[model samples]
Target: MARIGVIGTGYVGLVTAVGMATLGHEVVGMDKDEGKIRKLKGGEPPFYEEGLEDYLKRAMEEGRLRFTLSTEEAVKGARYVFIAVNTPMDDDGSADLSQLLSASRSIARALDGFSILIVRSTAPVGSLDAMVEVMREEGKERGRDYELAYNPEFLREGTGIYDFLNPSRIVVGADTPEVAEEVMSLYEGINSPKLTTSIKNAQIIKYASNAFLAARVSFINEIAAVCEALGGDVWDVAEGIGLDPRIGRHYLRPGPGYSGPCLPKDLMALIRMSEEYGHFPHFLEAIHLRNEAQKRRVVWKVKEALGGVFTGKTVGVLGLTFKPNTDDVRNSISIPILRRMSKQGARVKAYDPMGGENAKAIFGDAVEVYNDPYEALDGVDAVLILTAWEEFAKLDWDRIRERVRRPYIVDSVGIFRRGAPEGWRAWTVGKGDLPSPEVSPESDV
Candidate 1:
């Protein structure tokens, strides 16, 4: 087993450390955040990721994994140093590499012997070269003192641990074939095909993959809107189109928009990166613009369901996260929708299985976060299902009907596939089966 040092204890860094340790490697995870290091060392995950604590605890007990705040302690005597630091998006959608560059400089100073530095951060092309430059400026020649490699991560937040152990593919782009081989050996435990490429290709691979997925999502969302207008069903249309192996059935689900730690920012960053390289990515720009438009469309849907007014109205939201089983709410559609409603004098209440804390942090007093789904719906004028959580799907419709102040329901996630109750008004994405408003047909106004 090789000795591994991972810098950064975020979702990517911490998960990679625990996973590598579980594979029988001695791992030390480092983070500048003292409190985050303390929490991980105490067997607590700083964020809400499933299966993280158990893996961390098990690896800790096995003496294979440890957490630290000192980069020196982590890098000393390590064969592989994985740079998993955050590359946040700047105002112009360029990746802010301040943290990554700082980590690289710190790691450069601590390099004792020949150790492979793997950049697992989602950065622009040539970032690996930039790190190599940093190492050279720190008095370490690439071939003599150290080496740099780009190995981007594809781990999703909720199912990250599993994805790490069972990745679809592993890619590492190094300066030399020898370094690529060494990087491959580190992932020998994972039964995934390894692809070796140039460092620039690997960096672009991550960005390109994310941008393509975001494009598919936006494309389907546009079709979903058309379906809603023309009495067509998007789910069935997607099903038929997905049967073709070339057009696989992934990221095709219609929703308000694609959000999370990756999709939105990655698309924007890719666009910016392309511009920097003197390329005008018109198609990618369309995808980006369509995503923003989708969120606004959702807000319009909510207002339309409320009889074209939000003044003095109340809305209940069933989910706050971008998706189910994750606490990440970065760029989530629910945020804009809920905030827009609140600004229009419509009180907003929301419940999520895992994202409530993050929702509270983001929305503050503007939106109400609730523990129980029924409680979130209590006396609201309309209910919107933004995320596809099983708990939200299995809600007692009978009880919800009694608790909700109005019968107006909009399911953007296809929760009510069997259709809503007879006497209620309902709408959904792409289904196009909107029942008439809940006015008694026998009454002649």
Candidate 2:
């Protein structure tokens, strides 16, 4: 197996480090945070991701995984050093490459010779080329050229481990095809097809992939709004369109628009990159606008259900995370919707299965965060579901109907059924109206 060094112990870094080690590679994950390194060395994952801790522990037990704060120690004698640092966008929308450049400079300082430095961070198109320039500049000063490559990660936080092990394709980009071949050899155990390209194409591929998915989500969400207006079911519409062999279905669920670390940021970065090159990515721009509009659509739905105003309305929101089974709330669509509701004089009560703590940091005292989903509905005027956690699908809506002051529901994620309750008013995306339920005395309370 390849001897690997992973820099920057964030989600991607941690997963990549541990996963490579689990695949029998000798891995040393380096970070400047001593506390994080200490925690990881003791078998504690710095964040919550399903199965990451288990795999980390297994790798640690197998003596293949190691953590260090010193880059010198981590990269010494390692044949492959994977740079997995964050490349968050700046105020100008251009990628703030400071973190990446810092990590590259540090890796450069520690390089001995003939080691492949792989950039695995999601970066703007041409970013890999810029990074190669930095590496060659540093190498020139040190009188040695370090081999460089790029392997963009397509990992989703909640299902990161599964995605890594069963990736759809493995991409490796480099200065030359031979460098990509060397990089591909590192994943000998992986059965996925490999795509090799130049540095510029590799960087663009990552952004293009995310931007296309964002477009798909926004396109469907926009259609869902149209369907709602026309009394048509968007689910049926999307499924019908998705069945086309050319369009194959995935990411067509119309809900609170796509929000996570990747899509929004990558789209903005791509836009910024396009502006730099004197071109306008009109479709990507439209996608971004549509996503923001989707968030506002939730607010409009709330206002409609609450009689055209949120003044004095008690609104209960279910699901706070950007999506299901993930605690990450960066740019989560729920945050903006909550802020807008609260600003309009609505009392917001929210319950998320796992994102409460992160939500608390964002909302502060503006909204009441309930530990129990049912408790969040206490005396609320209407309930809105944002994230599509499976628990929401099976909720005792009969009990929730009894607790709320107003029998109104807005099912943005399709959590409520039609013909469920008398006096029950609900709006669902991509689906028909929620049915009123058969009322029973015991079930009502």
Most lDDT-accurate candidate:
1
Q: Could you give candidate 1's per-residue lDDT for residues 78-151 as a string of tens digits? A: 98999999988899988888898899999999989888889998989866677878888999898888888889
When summed lDDT is taken over every stretch of 10 residues in candidate 1, the lowest stretch is 436-445
User: Number of clashes in model 1?
Assistant: 0
What is the clash count of model 2?
A: 13
- Tens digit of per-residue lDDT, candidate 2, span 323-432: 99888877788888999999999999999999998889889999899999999988898888899898986777778777877777778887553433455667787554
Model 1 residue 121 lDDT score: 88
Candidate 2 regions exceeding 4 Å error are 132-143, 417-423, 431-445
Candidate lDDT values, in order: 0.86, 0.84
Alpha-carbon deviation at 225 in model 1, angstroms:
1.4
Task: TM-score for candidate 2, please give it.
Answer: 0.92
Clash totals for all models, in order?
0, 13
lDDT of 2 at 442: 21
